[model samples]
Target: MNSDGANDMNLAALLRAGADDELQPDQKAHLDAHLRDHPRDTDRIEFERQLKEACGRVMGPISAPPALRERLIASLDRIAQDNSPRQEASSTAPAPESVRLAQGVESLSEQTRRQSFWNRMTPAVRALAAAILLLVGGLFLLQVVNVGSGNLSLAQAHMSEIATFVGDEHDRCVIDPSRAAKFNISELDAAPALLEEIVGKSISPANLAFGGLAFRDGGRCHVPGKGDSVHLRFDVVDQPGETVSLFIQRVADESDELFESGKSYELQSDNQGRAVFGWAADGLNYFLVAKDEALCESYSIERGLTPNAG
Candidate 1:
């Protein structure tokens, strides 16, 4: 490929990596080179800035509640016990066919005439039929319980991760000047109201059924080589202390692109904090991160946002 073609491909990859929080060192270096060569390309500059900001936004520190952490650990322990060999054997074992048949036959006879054809059948045949019915019923009940447990377990696991990420990691915040200008805010001080508005505008009431909003706040800060940006935060009650952060900015030139097909946003945890989620919409780039990916997903959908799962 020609140099221009390679540059374009590298730039696109960098953009994708920015949204996913998976940008590699080589890719970052390539992007830096291109930015240096095309210093006047505001679009290129903003794109690079936004990508870096997204990374910082997702990697910011988070604080989880101690109670939630204890509960999560306890639940995990319970799950371990429930899955132990002895418990598994008891829960999975089926009643003996003969016993099941006897119980069913007794119940049927008590409800219907003793002289009926069903009643007159040989004891063996009656038992067989009863056993079949009991087996079917038991299987159906088992399936229902299994499905419920699966969903609960998934939610539980996500919650646990969120707790750890927020509690142990997030510390510093990053801002993208070009993007931050759009929100008309200077620092974290502008976060709370903006978060409330975004949640109110983007999140549907239906999505709230799975999880409720816990807290919303905002602030300001500087990132290396970047200017002031707005940081908006939202917390959910069920997830407890898990937060979603949104970073917004405005630029005079058209550099960063808005949400579009094949484009993604993400929040990721850094060494300093837990995971975060981020994306862009309506001239704003957003990062929503928590240790609980499931909760983050729900929040994404509620706010009419898509996750950069890639």
Candidate 2:
């Protein structure tokens, strides 16, 4: 290859490594120098950044079910085993220094012979293999989840989006109590009516306040990408720092529908640390997010929305 062609290849490899967050400090310096010379490549980097952000928005918030998670873990292990070297090398054959540098592998000849199988695979081959694995794993996950079965359906994705949004708000307020408006127990009487005016559902705070939970504070909050929602926080009576959040939002809006109407769903958690138990009542969707899974179940049962154990 000509010098320009070789430089193009090197730049491409560096860009890919940077996108994957696998670039070493020296490789990053190299990428920085190349980009300074070729400003036009900035568009490619921007495209990669946008694509990664979009994927995270869509997939990162959703937590896989335990069964599907285990299956994927097992599949990954099997792939690693399959890719493992089958025999000891008779001689120390060194990979090209450029390849070693790009891969962030040691340049020493002995280290080259002991390089990880994944590090040895070309980027093209690794990408193709990853795509194939994702395709198969996605299909397997779909089968395991049994979509459209009325139980835990595809709607969970939408639910997860909402849960993640609320969970983040919950975390922010808890970490910095000053960010949260203090809840007056006296206002509990009018809070339901206020929520009803906005969300069209009136819930009795007495019913939700249980397990040493006392009303802390609440106010209007917005789900980042979706729309408006109402937030209510409760302090675990004896536990100083522990809190729970109750969220009320329209079941469906012009843009997105959170839960299927007339269907009962169970408690679940997004990728966030909190567990979320949600139900649709009247025209509003109610979500209870707490750190304790037992609290989620308790809240669901309190609402008499827990599905049968069958």
Candidate 3:
């Protein structure tokens, strides 16, 4: 392209990179010069600055309604599974409607993965993605903060909410490893040690047993109005397709009747026969998801993970 065309291209790149903090020194310098030379472009820069500021506020973060976030994360997994090149049994993707939604989310996920890619997109794309997720569970996020400001209680609604959180978290880590890496627990420490510190509770991976699932990885899960909650991933020994994920987080308390009566653990299974158990332990809430029902049942039976608290 000609010099003017090249400069325009650079300007476009600078605009995109500026929003994503990917602007190189030279590119930023060039952008600054160009903006100074052209007052109209300055307005565009201001708009981008504002947009970036907004995205910073509402990302993956606080008090997002469990139901809404889970719905969105499930969309990511189901679409990816459908589109997976490995799924040659059927060449068709999900309905166009679902595909479109998934594409939008995956596209955002991909762009956000790399600073350079995010820096190359137009402001319109960035604004659309940031707004979409930011709006989900926003009201619920506010509510979480509000409740947390007061005493923490496991109200009926909160009980159901935590249940769904565990279920979705299980899928998030297993269904799509790449997506789950967004909140990966990469700290350099043993799983139990990290959990003790991060969640402010004490528990051992050996104690949890996980029904013969070997501990593979562990990390924190973020919820609105909550800090870092540990999510530990495990794989069933010698079982290629079976996986287990456990989430442990500090809670207000479990002395209430909801988690007692020897029926504290709830076993939920899907049509595919996958089952997950959620319960409160002393003070920490735990969700253990089993990917293979047969193996999980055998292990759960062995581990005393009956309908009652273990």
* TM-score per candidate: 0.29, 0.45, 0.44
Stretches of candidate 3 off by over 4 Å are 1-70, 73-154, 182-189, 223-228, 253-258, 292-310
- Superposed on all Cα atoms, model 2 deviates from the true structure by an RMSD in Å of 21.7
Q: Which candidate, 1 or 3, would have the higher TM-score against the true structure?
A: 3
Of candidates 2 and 1, the better by lDDT? 2
**Per-candidate RMSD, Å:** 22.6, 21.7, 20.5
Q: Cα deviation in Å at residue 206, candidate 2?
A: 3.0
Which ten-residue region of model 3 has the weakest summed lDDT? Answer: 140-149
Ten residues in a row with the worst lDDT in model 2?
140-149
Per model, state how many residue pairs clash: 42, 1, 5
lDDT of 2 by residue, 1-310 (tens): 2344334456676776667666766667788888899988877887887898999999888777785576457544432332233211222565464332322211111221232334544676456445544544422210001132124322444554465456666776777666566433335666676666656666675654665678776777775334456788888776688888887776455344544543323333332256666666555667778876545544544443322111
37, model 2: CA deviation in Å?
45
lDDT of all predictions? 0.40, 0.54, 0.51
Which residue pairs clash in candidate 3? 62-224, 63-141, 63-224, 63-225, 185-219
Any runs in candidate 2 off by more than 4 Å, and if so which? 1-155, 181-186, 224-227, 252-256, 260-272, 305-310
lDDT per residue for candidate 1 within 1-310, as digits (tens), equals 2344335565566655544455456666666676678765547556677877887889876778675587568645533432343334445665565433333322221222212323444666456545543644422110001112113333223323332332322322222234333334333334444434543223222322223554354544221112234445555576564555544432112333323322232323222134444334444444455554434433444343322221
- For model 3, residues 1-310, the per-residue Cα lDDT tens digits are 2344345555666777665666657667777788788878877877888877788776635787776677888755744643453234434655476444433333322321223323443676446434432544222110011122123344433444554466666775666667566444543247666777787765654565643566677777753224357777777787786667766666644432234322224334433234554445455555566654333333333233322132
